[model samples]
Target: MKAHPFLLHKWQHWLALGFGSGLAPKAPGTFGTLAALPLVWLLALISPLWAGVAIVAAALLGVYLCEVVSRDIGAEDHGAIVFDEIVGFAITLWAVPFNLQNVLLAFVLFRLLDILKPWPIRWFDRNLHGGLGVMMDDIVAGVLACLLLHSVWLPLQL
Candidate 1:
């Protein structure tokens, strides 16, 4: 693939690239997830139910965005297609409190789960194809991170 096949002017490409965070020379996924922090903070400001609804909407849209960019770039899961990372991070902090500790913990956990790709996460990454495939593993990682936060980390803090 070329150094950058995605055009930032195109909304689909712009979003799929995580608002250009994916254009980073290295670790675009990490940068994309970092970019999601502001969105997560904004979501935390709203009702948890509404935040959840928004996340669901983003996830649904991410399917199309990932697919379009993947096809355009002729790469199944191009590193530049980091919409999955953004949505995944959103999912990770869906209803978590808006605080530095929680945010940092969620970030670390989500990145680890995403990067390590354990169990079913790895399974989805390997078995699936297309945009759904691009998004599934990160989705799973987000769920795992969220679960860890609510069930273990948060509880321990109490």
Candidate 2:
């Protein structure tokens, strides 16, 4: 695979690279998602609504950033472009309490659902193109991960 020529100075590229976490030579998506954990935890300190807003903003801005980066890189959803993963992780943790266990679970579940892309997630990933396509599949995965965490473990804790 040809390496993307990521200009370090550009803000959009910086975001597309997940603030440098997405620059990892391998598994950039995983690193991007991992980097989102702290921000999610910090946002968890605020209202969940605020976190939701932030995630929404990320998704919305990600469209332009992803599109620009993909075009620059000459590939669609290139591994180095990981803003979607970062935003997806944030969406996965929305409304969930700030706890180590929940964070870890969200990480695992989000990554799995994202990588596996079952059902609509898979459909969206395959059918969608450009920025919306890059972000939508991960959005679906994030929602499913959030739902799984809430449904499977909320009852256990209560």
Top TM-score model: 1
* RMSD of candidates 1 onward, in order: 1.6, 1.7
Evaluate residue 77 in candidate 2 and report its C-alpha lDDT on the 0 to 100 scale.
87
lDDT of 2 by residue, 1-158 (tens): 76458877788889898999988888889999998987888888888878788789889999989888888767898877888998888888888887888989999999999888899899999999998899899999999998998997779878
TM-score, candidate 1, is 0.94
State TM-scores per candidate: 0.94, 0.93
lDDT of 1: 0.90
Segments in model 2 whose C-alpha atoms lie over 4 Å from true places? 1-3
Clashing pairs in 1: none
- Measured with C-alpha atoms, the lDDT of residue 122 in candidate 1 is 99
Local error of candidate 2 at 92, Å?
Answer: 0.7
Q: Model 1 Cα RMSD, Å?
A: 1.6
**Residue 94 displacement (Å), model 1:** 1.4
